[model samples]
Target: MKTRIKKMSDDLLWIFYPTLCAACDRPLLMGEECLCTFCKYYLPRTHFHLQSINPVAKHFWGKVPIQAATSYYYFSKGEKVQRLIHKLKYKDRKDVGMYIGQLMGSDMKDSPFPKPDIVVPVPLHEKKLKLRGYNQSDFIAEGFAKSMNAVFEPQMVYRNKETETQTRKHRFDRYMNMDNVFSINKELAASDKNILLIDDVITTGSTLISCAEALLEIPGTKLSIASIACA
Candidate 1:
């Protein structure tokens, strides 16, 4: 009887304040976190975490020496993963990022990669952060930190200036734009720990490479990279 009452209370709250799926923009069913059931099953999973030479890792081949790199899902044009990312990035659906991060963290717990000493989210420019009211990647890192029982440093690296979107830029242009864009904070640098860098997505990987380069400048620091999705 108590469980039924709690269910009815939840239903009434939903009726008054419906929560929609980040991917499909439809009302989420009871117990659903972010995506609807169909969308969740249909999301393009990358399975890159199980592979050593996947596209995600290849993106940094010879550019940076990362211990490991992987993404949770594959991103394609007009796909559910793309839609989910768009909502998390532009529609203020930070819960989506956190949910995905938690799932990824669970998988990593069983993988061979050593648990990182610290987790750092790729930083957004202050102007963009102010406009968005939150850094989606930081929320993602928070989920990973909780599940992995590791320290989360949301401000380990910072964007020194606003950068143009890399979506339309060539590979070289993207690298040029991201070069030296991140600066490591001295407090974070002094730890000299193995770090897991977190981000929402990995496309050209310019951003992660840039952040990794900054961290590598610090003595005795090692880096790995993870993201919610990859393109």
Candidate 2:
């Protein structure tokens, strides 16, 4: 009886303030979420987890030692992926990350991708985190951890320095901007355990490279990387 009432209430509220799809801006039907079914179906999944030497892994070649790397989707400008990401990062829709993470986790269930003992999201600086009121990546990592049955350790890595946005920076300049920016918590470090680093997106991968370098400092730690999308 209570569930019926809640559903009715939601339907009434939706009628007055319709929830639009993040990608297409269409009013979402009942039971649809941040994205409609059509957008979700065609979101450009990379399926990189199925390949060992995929492009994401190759990007880290000679730069950092990662067991493997994959991204759930291919991101492009003015596309559905970008719109979904913009909603998550700039529009306070953290659930978008969780939704995407759960989908990514499900897709990796039978793949050859290495499972990690711990899942950690790339941290945002204190100032940026304060302004944002949340780390969007945390929801992604949290949902992924739940689906993967791994430990979610958001504090395992810390961002000590506030760096400028890499949106307009060149590759080398982005690498320099992210240098010495991340540090790991010694107490949380698990020696000889696999750690999966999560990020929302990978462009030049400079940020992930810096985070991976810090995570590798832990003795006997095997590191891997995953992201919501690759640009």
Candidate 3:
């Protein structure tokens, strides 16, 4: 009876507040989660988790050696995926990150994706972190940690230099700019363990490469990458 009453109260509150889908801005129905049924079906998924040599893995070829790479969705410009990214990054909607990460974790739970020793998010520079009041990717990492039962290490590495956004830069420029800009923690560096590197989004895979390079400095450290979405 108590559980039913709480559910009823939550339902009553939603009628007054009208919860909307984060992706499509449609009113959420009784059974819908973060995204509406239409948006969930329409959103492009990479299904990269199923392949050993997916496109995301190919991006790191001849660059960083990664165990595997997967992204939850394919990002298209002006799409609902961007709306989810916007809310998570700019609107202080940290739950959005957790929800996406949980979905990714659930997918990989029974897949061939190797289990990780720990989950680390691409660290944000202190200045940007201060302005944003939180690291959006940290929430992603947390959700993944919970689902995968891995340690969530938010401070495993940090941005040593604040770099320009990679949005307009050429691929080479992005790689060059991010090089040597991150530093891994000694605790993580001293071990030969698998680390699951996480981020909110990936484009040209420059940022993940930079981060993986830092983690590889650790003896016997194997790297795998996961992101909420990728272009």
Candidate 4:
């Protein structure tokens, strides 16, 4: 009886405030959440998790030691993926991140992707966190951790300083800008643990690298990386 009542209430709510798909902005069906069925079908998956040495993994070669690295989707400018990410970051649509991260987590289950002991999201500086009201990556990591059965430690890393956005910076400049920006929480740090670091996107990988470096400071910590998209 309660289920039937809730359904009727939801239907009435939809009539007044329809929940549109995050990707296509289409009215979502009863079973649909965040993305429409067509948009979810068309998301560009990298399938990099199946390969040992994908482009994402190659990006970190000779730079940092990683157990594995993969991105769930290929990100392109001015496309559905970008729009979805924009909604997650700027539009206060955190469900989009969680939805995408859950999809990624489903892919990783019993797959080539290494199981992680802990899952951590890239942190935002206090100023940005306050301004944004939430860290976008936390939602992503939360969904991922749920599916992977890993500990979600959103505060595992702290951003020490605020830096300018990396969107317009050159590759080298991006690296310099992220240098020494992250530090690990010693209380949460543990040795001989496999850690999965999560982020929304991977462009030049400078941000992930800096976060990985801080987490790697703890002894016997093996790091892996995953993101919603890779540009």
Choose the strongest candidate by TM-score: 4
Predicted candidate 1 versus true structure: per-residue lDDT over 1-231, tens digit per residue = 999999899899999898888877889888887888877776778778788778899999999989889998888889778888888888888888888888788888988765788989999999999998999999899888878988889987899989998989999999999978989788767557889999998989999999999988878887899998888
For residues 61-157, could you state the per-residue lDDT of candidate 3 as single tens digits?
A: 8999999999989888898999999999999898888878887888899999878988999999999999999999999999998888888999989
lDDT of 3 at 214: 89
* Segments in model 2 whose C-alpha atoms lie over 4 Å from true places: none
Candidate 3 residue 167 C-alpha distance from true site, Å: 1.6
Residue 179 lDDT in candidate 2? 97
- What are the lDDT scores of the predictions, listed in order? 0.87, 0.92, 0.89, 0.91
TM-score of each: 0.91, 0.95, 0.93, 0.96
Q: Model 1: how large is the Cα RMSD against the reference? A: 2.1
User: Per-residue lDDT of 1-231 in model 4, one digit per residue for the tens?
Assistant: 999999999899998898998887889988888989998888888999999889999989988899999998899999889999999999999898888888888888979789999989999999999999999999999999988888999988999999999999999999999999999888878899999999999989999999999999999999999999999
lDDT-based ranking, best first? 2, 4, 3, 1
The CA lDDT at 2 in model 2 is 100
Specify the poorest-scoring 10-residue window by lDDT in model 4: 96-105
**Candidate 2 residue-wise lDDT, 27-135, digit = tens:** 9998898889998888788989999999999899999989999999999999888888899999999888888888888888778999878999999999999999999
Give candidate 3 regions above 4 Å deviation.
1-8, 188-190
- Point out where model 4 deviates above 4 Å: none
CA RMSD of each candidate after superposition: 2.1, 1.4, 1.7, 1.2
lDDT of 4 at 153: 92
How far in Å is the alpha carbon of 40 misplaced in model 3? 3.8
